[model samples]
Structure formats: C-alpha cells, structure tokens
Target: MKFSPLETPLRTIMTPGPVEVDPRVLRAMCTPILGQFDPAFTTIMNEVMEMLRQLFRTSNRWAYPVDGTSRAGIEALLCSIIEQGDKVLIPIYGRFGYLLTEICERYGAQVYTIECEWGNVFAPEEVIDEMKRVQPKIVAIVHGETSTGCMQPLEEIGRACREMDILLVVDAVATIGGTEVNADEWHFDGVIGGTQKCISVPSGMALITYNDRIEKVVLSRKKVERGIQTDSDRSILAAGKTIISNYFDLSQLQDYWGPRRLNHHTEATSMVYALREGLRIILEEGLTERFDRHRLHERALIAGIEAMGLSLFGEKKWKLPTVTCVNIPDGVDGESVRHMLLHEFGIEIASSFGPLHGKIWRIGTMGYSCRKENILKVLTSLEAVLVYHGVHVNKGEGVQEALKVYIEQSKAIGAGR
Candidate 1:
C-alpha cells in the first residue's frame, strides 16, 4: 500500500484543552534533533527548567517536565510522596478533582474526600475545616477545574496547609499560563502544569515544579535502576521503599534532569523543543499582560453568551477565565450544535462529562485561542447553530454584545494612553 503526505483540516479549536498550538511552537517542533547527552541539548534542557520556574512562579531548585501528558506529572508527584496507606485528603469539586483521588487510591493511599456541587467551588474554609478533620498527611486539589469551568481559591488553603504542616500538592494544569500560579508564594510542595491548554503547545509534556519539602520525600524513596546504576549507586541505600513505578519515578528523573545527567530514558527531542519555545513565548508576552488578556477575552465571551439568551453554568465569581461553561438551551441538541459548528464552520468546542454531559457545553478561550477574532468567530457561529436547532436566540445580538466589549476596552486603553 502507498500513502500520500499527511493532511489535516484546519480548525479553530475552542475546547477545554488541546485548544490550539501556536505556529511558533509548531515550527520549533520541526527543528533538527540533537542527541540527549550532547552539551548543546543539555543547555536547552537547563533553559526549559529555568523557563518553567518562571512560568510556575517558583524559586524551587527542582523544576522539569514529565514525558507524558499532564496526568503523568500528577502521578509522579503523588506516587512518589504516598507510601502504603498514607492518609490523603482530596476535595472533589469537578472531574479533575476526582482524578487526584483515583491516582492516590491506585497507589495504596487511604484517600478521603469532601464534595461540593459540580459548578460550585468550595470556600477555602470548607477545605481547611475538612483537612483539620481528616488530618491527612497530604492535601491535593485542583486550581482550575475545567470540567465545570470553576476555579478553586488556593491562597488561603495554601497558608492553612503550611500552618498545619501538611504537604500541599496542586494540579494547576488548566490555570498555569492563562492565570497566576505562584508555586512558592502559595507554599505548594509540588505543582503540575500542562502544555495543551494555556501554554499554546501540543499535549506531549507535563511541567512539574517541586520545593525542598517534596524533594526530601522523593529522595527518601529513591532507587536507581540496575540497568543504569553505577558502582557508587549500588552503595546508596534503597531502604526497600522505592517508588512503585520506574517510568513515573521522580528520584531517578531528578538525576537525569539535574547536573548528574544520569541516564533515565532517551528524552523526547522534538517535544522538548516545542516546550522551550512555548515557554519562551509566554515569558516574552509577559505573565501579567497575558493573564489580563485572558480575562478580557473571557468577559467578551460571557457578554456574547448572555446576549444570546443562554445562561452560564457556574458561580460567576469562581468561573475559570480559560474555559466558559454554558447551560444548554432547553430542547436543543447539544451534540448537533457542536457537529454543525465543526463541519460547517470549521470550529470545535467541547462537551462536559458525568452529570454535566448533556446539560452544559464547554467553550475554551485559552492561550493562542484567546483572541478577539476567535472569540467573535465562536460566538457568531454558535448563535447561528443554536438558532438553526430551534433554540430561540436574539438574532445578531451575540456578535453585537461581544463587539461592544472589545470596543469599550479599546476606548478605555486609548483614554489611559
């Protein structure tokens, strides 16, 4: 059989994740590969670690990327810290929150959970109170729960965890580049971030940063593999408590990413290039300005959705700026609308999982996808699809309202200037 060159349809991705890759990042992926141990390649590795430290807003000595998607970092952090039957408290507010629980359970952790409604976030005090009651060794929570378009506040929780002497690990996958993720300031022991959503990179790397607190725990369980162990490594104590999975182990990974340069596995050459370029783009744009841009686009999107006579699905105060959840109109076929939007308009949006499956539609405005043109395109296309599906939307009002937001912002900026 013969095959032709690969071709894919162009799409305006507006989904919770895997949103859109920046052209620069895509171009970087095409750069020639270098051997893993080459001095030049190692320099790029060091650059990625430094850029990640800036992106995560941390001064931690340990910062690197896991080779898999965001979940790989989450797994590595959790499994490394958790021993047999250690108590872990995970607050369940959205689908991703439950993922923490699942990872912990699989690693033999005695996981405890507290719950709130899907579209609502728990007050900081609520989680603190539960933490006190559970008295768990670790507290794992999500910063932004894209599953329901809700963002949980972490400042107060982080402070409380510090006072209580509990390890605080956070899943900041959806919030990293689009908003503020202060790793050191928040007192997080470990935090995991993703590339697909707000980093404008492809979904192949998971950025992770850890403070000394987490490093102590991970090193205590360290075990170098026999295949790569040196004569000195044989003398090092294994303590018979090595981490469960070799591929997800952080102790050995640290040495590979660290100055020791001990071999773990061959690095993903193109993916590392993509990540370096992606992080560079973010820092060049300026974190504060980028966050404000996300907020500005979010406001425009919400204005348009409300003008179309559709209600948003979460607490307004806690809605994630990167993703917007809209209550599906009564009698409207949610999948049909999405299908038409994809096929006819060359656009893509996402649907929710579990209870929110058919009740709400998730639209993302993140990183490269968060722009005036893209926002207007999604709102306009969605309005057309909803009206065609017999959902009574105010004709032309969606685009008008969105345009009003953009116009007003421009005027405010001009006046300030």
Candidate 2:
C-alpha cells in the first residue's frame, strides 16, 4: 500500500472521545523539548500532578497521567492492584463496564459481574446489594458508559464501599472534566480519565489518581517485583508476584512522576504539554461553570433532536452530558445518515456498541467541540441527512427548538447572576 503525505479530514469531531483539540493546547505541545529528568521538565510534571488533583477533586498525592490512552490507566490500576485469585466485583451496565470485568479477569481476579440493561444505569442501592452479597475485594465500575450514553451515580455506592471497607475503582474517562468527578468526595480509591474527551487534548494520555488504600495494595505487589529484580528473599516473593505488565507498573510509573524521578520510561513530553495546557484551561474556566456549559449544550441538542421527530435512547436522568444516543427512525438506515453527515456536511457522529449498532446514533458534545454553534450545525446537518434518506423531518424546526432552549437557559443564567 502506498500512502501520501498526512492530510486528515476537516470534519467536526462529535464522537465520544478524542474530541476537537484546542489550538492553544496544540501550540503548547510545540514547546521545545526538555530532558525527562531536567529540572524544568520535572517542574512541569509536578505542576501537572497538582492540577490533576484539582480536576479529580482529590487531595491524593498519587495523581498523575499514564503514558497512553484512557485504557492504559484502567489496565495499570487493575494489573497493579488485582493479585492472583483476588475477588473483584464489576457492575456491567455497558461496553466499558464489561471491559473492567475483562481486565480484572485477565489479572487473575475472580470476577463477579452484575448486569444492568444497556441504555440504563444501576441504582446505587442495587450495586451495594450485589457488593454485600459477593463481598469482593474491589468494586470496579464505569462512571460514564459512552456506548450507552449513561452516567452512573457513584456517591451512594461510594459510601457503601467505605462502609464495607471495599475498594472503589472508577473509569471516568468519559465523564471526568465534562461532568462532576469529585474522586475524594465520592470515596473512589482509584479513578482514571482520558485527556481527549472533555479535556480536549490529543488522545495519548490517561489521568489517574489513587488513595492510600489503593497505594498500599499496589505497593505490596511491587515489592514482589523488587524481590525478583534484586534477588532478595524469595520467601517474601511467595506472598506476591511481579506486576503483570512492565510498561504499566504503577509503582515504577509513580516513582517516575514522584520525587525520586525514577526513569521508568521515556515520558510523552508533547502529550504532557498538551495535558498541562488542557488542565490549565479547565481550571481557568472553573469546574462547576464548565459542567453547566456542558449541561446547557446537551439540553439544546436533545431539544433539536426532539423537534426533528426523533427520540433519545437512554433515560434523561441517567444520560451523560458529554454523549447522547438518538434512536434511528423507522426505515431509515443509521449508517447511511452518519455517512451523509460526514461526507456531505463534513460532520462526524458515532454509532453504538454491539446490539445498539445500526439502531442508534451516538452524538457527542464534549471538550472543545461542545459549543452552541456546533450543536446547531450538527442538528441542522442531521435533519438534512434524515430528509435525504426519505425520512420526513421539519427542516428548520431543529435549530429553532434548540435556540429556544438556549434562550431560556441564557435568561435563567442572567437572572441567577
């Protein structure tokens, strides 16, 4: 195969992840490279960790970014924490929840997964009940299930975990900066996120944090790794095994970001620059205000879809602010509509996972792309695509309805101020 010089499409990204990158972040990533252990680079690393603590709403000292996508953080947390034969309880609500189950099982954890229907989320009580019954060492869950556009409520479940003395791990890759993710307040032992979603950076880094409880568990396993490397006492190594992954070993990675400044691997310097700029942008905007912004746009997008005579897939109360799922109209091909939206209007939206594929459309209002004009553009373009497929839709109603919601919300904000 022959390929030409790199030139990507200009389509507006409206997918669940790797949303539009802010130009400011792009420029920050272009800064001159510094050696990984250089004082200036170490300072930036420290700053990034501190900012991550703010974003995660945690005072935990272990907050830092993994060197890969959001999944890297997930695997790092799991592979490091789940020792052989450890019992882990996973509540499977969507594709990502099943992912946790898969990862935990791979790490030799006996996985017990309680299922909830797709397009819906579990009540905290239900999860707590399962946890009580199963009595697992760790309760791993997805904070936001992107495939189904549902955000799981974790506060009550968190308290339940604290009461039972069980570890609470959350995959907040889809919800972190776009919604509320107070890791400490929610009592999450381990929390993971991606910079590409609401944070609006390029998709290469995973923001991760863990509390002391989790640190203890991970460090115990790392001690075994140390024994193997240093050929110390083999007896202490019997109680623990080396962490399954060399690249994702949390102890070494943490040391690399920690005061020791251990050289675990070559840090992704450019992505670090991007993540720091993105975190700075989030801090400057204020987390609460950013959440309101996401909420406002999500409302407008729903209004537009409704005005076009389409219904949403998931329950509104459980719906994610960053992503929304629209049911495909009867007799209209979902992929055809997505194809038209992309090729004809230079717009991109996503399709759902497994059973929902071809039956629903997943549109995202996340990161830098979560703006008023983009919402209007997507709705208007979507309406055109629906009509092209012989689905009769009110042409102008979409944007008009969206504008009405925007106007009402703007007035409400002004009144409050």
Report the number of the highest-TM-score candidate: 2
Q: Alpha carbon lDDT of residue 374, candidate 2? A: 93
Residue range with the least summed lDDT across 10 consecutive positions in model 1:
233-242
Off by over 4 Å in 2: 1-4, 228-240
Q: Model 1, stretches more than 4 Å misplaced? A: 223-240
lDDT of each: 0.92, 0.91
Candidate 2 yields a Cα-based lDDT of 0.91
TM-score of 1: 0.96
For model 1, how does the per-residue alpha-carbon lDDT over 1-417 read when each residue is reduced to its tens digit? 999999999999999889889999999999999999999999999999999999999999999999999999999999988887789999999999889999999988999999999999999999999999999999999999999999998999999999999999999999999998999998899999999999989998899999999988887656444333666555442432346798888888999999999999899999999999999999999999999999999999999999989999999999899999999988788999999999999999999999999999999989999999999999999988887888888988988999999999999999999
Would you list the clashing residue pairs of candidate 2?
Answer: none
For model 2, residues 120-155, the per-residue Cα lDDT tens digits are 999989999999899999999999999999999999
